[model samples]
Target: MEKSKIWVFVSVLCAMFVLVACAPGSGGSPTPTPLPPVSSYEKSIFTVEEGPIVEEKQLMGEIVPSRQEELFFRASGFVTRVSVKQGDVVKKGTVLAEMQVDDLLNQLQQARIDLEVAQANLAKDKAQREYDIQKATAEVTIWKMRVADAQLDYDRAVGIQKEKALLNLNIAKENLALAEAALKLVQENTNPYMEQAVKRSQLAVERLEGLLAERQIVAPFDCVVLRAIIRPGQQVDAFFVVFVVGDPSELIVRSPYDFDLASKMTDKIEVNLYFDSKDEKGYTVSYLPNFLPVTTNKEATTTRSSGDYFYFSLPKEIQQQDLKVGRTVFLKVILGRKEKALLLPPSAIREYKGLRFVIVQDGEKRRRVEVNEIGLKGTDKWEIVADLKPGDKVVGP
Candidate 1:
């Protein structure tokens, strides 16, 4: 029995030894552990650098003609010919366009005929006035002769003592007085009539003169024709804008700005503009020009709040080539620049309740640093107003 018990104990000891060989050891050259998995998000370490920091402001604006004018026709007529075209430069009184004055000519001719009739009527009035004067003179002579004859008959009858001849002579004197009174009335009325006819003729001539002035069209100042709205022989109304002429030298740029940005920007602020052309030119603030209020789409914007925005005017840069009329552009206004600023990647800084913090890694330990005035230098980079020591490891997720 003792021998059998010894054999069983030996077999169990062998099994215990096999189990010990399969189990892992706690110390003394333990198995190497695997490192934790790395995160998929992109990250960067922040380091201190010296120099001025340039803040690139991103804004949207438009290219507009600095000078624009709409040429309007004040008189109604058929357009006879358009002498100029779009993009043509013209001077003052240069016939940019001509109109058919045939209708106006006809009207003027009719007015002239009316004036001639008035003159003829005036001449007839003058002739009648002369005839009235002659008739008045002849009546006065007849009256004098009758008076003399009556006097002679009255004296003879008085001397002969005849009542019948004396009565006839008295009646003749009274009739001569009545004839003189009628002649005076015609002289006064006829001169007034003749004067009125002369005034009517003068007024008719003045009306025709005004019509002739309307038939001629002339430009008021030197400008370029921006648009040609009419062709030859096209009937146009007086209210229609025919040619759009504007001063090219005094051009201004019209751009819509964000309402919020407009407040931040002063009317005195200038900007650097980049054009699509090979040469990116710039312009400065010369004039505020005009302000226009407009509404924006809520869904179309990502940065601006919904409300009215101001459309600002900018000075123009004239060129020989036809400039882009309606195109969006980027602008950078110089607000301020800081030299020898401490900069770090924007990812390195974290914010909490308006306080900016940066996680610093030092030999397996993490600490937080507070900073102020964290200006953005570039994409994913920032400028801090605190001391960012060089060679520091920045931590972020």
Candidate 2:
């Protein structure tokens, strides 16, 4: 019986060893153990505070003159002369450039000569008509005197001599009548065809002069040539810009009109401008209203309503800076501001689905508080309206 018991114990020991060999620690995959719960305090935490919330918008702009002229040619031709170059100070009506207009000049001269000839021909006709009328009048008077003499002779003579005198008197009367008719014709006649010729020639001269003017570019105002686009012998098309001139003494910053900025503008709003070539120091500028007249060129002085650009007048000192036209600039405007508001970092706010909330700490407990409204979102912080106070602590997502 002792021997049988020893064998059963050995078998049990062997089975136990086999079961241990088949266990997970020996060959099968081990089960994972769960980690401890993480505390909300371990994550990022922020405390709401009362501070000024300012909303600023930045836009790219360009420096420009307050009033400028874009000079262009009305007719296309090869540029024959460029009298002024860039930065040339000039007076009004100063010729800046000219196109190939030798033909135009020759045509204009011919038209002027033609006009002179037409005028001379008209004058000559007038003088000749007067002389002819005078000559005809004199002939009529002489014939009348001869008729009177013949009539006297006819009345004093016998039969044959009376007949001869009557015949002479009749002949003299006919001559006098012919001379009077000639004088009437001369006095009543008008050389309308000659007068029309004179008018036509004058119009041709004026037309040529106008065409000649189109081939030249003249300064419209006293200005400095900001840019000279046409070089000598450059071919250009009609209405092509040849020069950009402006009063450099008066400069302004211009940009594309922003509808978003326009909607936020108020009477008390301020504008700040930063030039790319300069430091971060901002310059204050005044916004020009659309109703104000802005002279663009000599032909017209238009208002801002006629253009799609924004204008801001700079301080005189700022205008004196070495800023070039079309230089890139940055503009900043404070759209809204609140002096004492509940401000928090954007990261502290949490959004799930469509609801925005924040994890607020209440003493020893944390609770989710819904953000009722967000106002004046700034660069680094957000103005939040919630049930929590300014001193509340919030956990980040």
Candidate 3:
């Protein structure tokens, strides 16, 4: 019994020792203290810089004719031959195309027949006028003969009357009056016939003038043929687009600019262009025109650039192949610039109003700084032009 009691006491003592060893803070070995919580505030720094930043604006435009014109057959005819093809250069009155003269010739023949008929009518009318004049002259001669006979009778009557004999003097006077009436009637007819002949001659003159104008097809202006809308032997009308002609010298590049960006630009702004179809060294600088073009955003890639888009003439490229009038090319324009400006990640700055501000860490204190002349440095980065000194802390992106 005594040995069992001693063994039981020993086991109880050993269990109590294990409990004391496992208990918190009982063993001499130290407990790891919880580390202090880290503060949530952290940021970066930048220096206020003085340098240049190239401020630029990008715009898109199209190649267009100085003037685009749709050439058509002013009159009707089968196109006999097309002397020009798409992309052909032509001069005014160069006869880029010709019509089968068959119809024109037929019309000419008809016009000639009409002219002949007019001539014949004119001749007939003239002849009638001459005949009427001759008849008037003959009638006047007959009247003069009758008047002379009446005068002789009147003289004989007057002599008889002077001798106190009964005579018919009144009847002689009435005969003279009737002859004058007949002469006036013939003269009136002759005058009317001459007037009618004059009218016919005037009509003939107008018909000849119209026919001459129709026989020639001439270009109205200098232009490049963009497309041949008509083929040989094809009959075209005044409304048909026979040739899409444009003056290459009139070609201009058109580009879209963001509206907000465009508002900041001035007239005669400088721009650079790159032609995908041409070499990169072909960069050309052009000035913006005095007036901005009216445009709608519904047709553009974005609605924001409607009033911001513009056009520039490809003054030098007009002579280059593939840079023809009405051919489109790409363009870029530079608006403004700044030099060697101190910059920070745009993410580091907070923009408000027109002014940009950044939070700088001064030891443990955070201070707000106003950035002047904020310029773009790169994607999502900006250079601040204001009061940041070197070694100043900034909120980093």
Highest-scoring model, TM-score: 2
Residue pairs with backbone atoms closer than 3 Å in model 1 (clashes)? 51-340, 52-339, 52-340, 66-251, 66-252, 67-251
Ranking by lDDT: 2, 1, 3
Q: What digit string (tens of lDDT, one per residue) describes model 3 on residues 292-372?
A: 332222322221222545556555644567665544566656655565667566677777777778887777887887877
lDDT of each: 0.63, 0.82, 0.61
Candidate 1 regions exceeding 4 Å error are: 1-43, 56-68, 71-85, 91-105, 112-220, 227-244, 252-260, 273-332, 347-357, 368-373, 376-380, 385-392
TM-score per prediction, in order, is 0.46, 0.59, 0.47
Cα TM-score of candidate 3: 0.47
TM-score of 2: 0.59
- Which has the higher lDDT value, candidate number 2 or candidate number 3? 2
lDDT for model 1, please. Answer: 0.63
True-structure lDDT of candidate 2:
0.82
Query: Model 1 over residues 1-397: C-alpha lDDT tens digits?
Result: 9999999999999999888877877336676799999965334555656567666455566644444545545568877767888777788888676676666677677767866777788788878878887888798788879878877876777555557767777777787887788788877775566567667767766876565445444555776666677888888776456665666554444445555455556666656655543345665543252442111223222223223333445544545353454456556666556776677877677888988888878777878878868774655567787645766677763
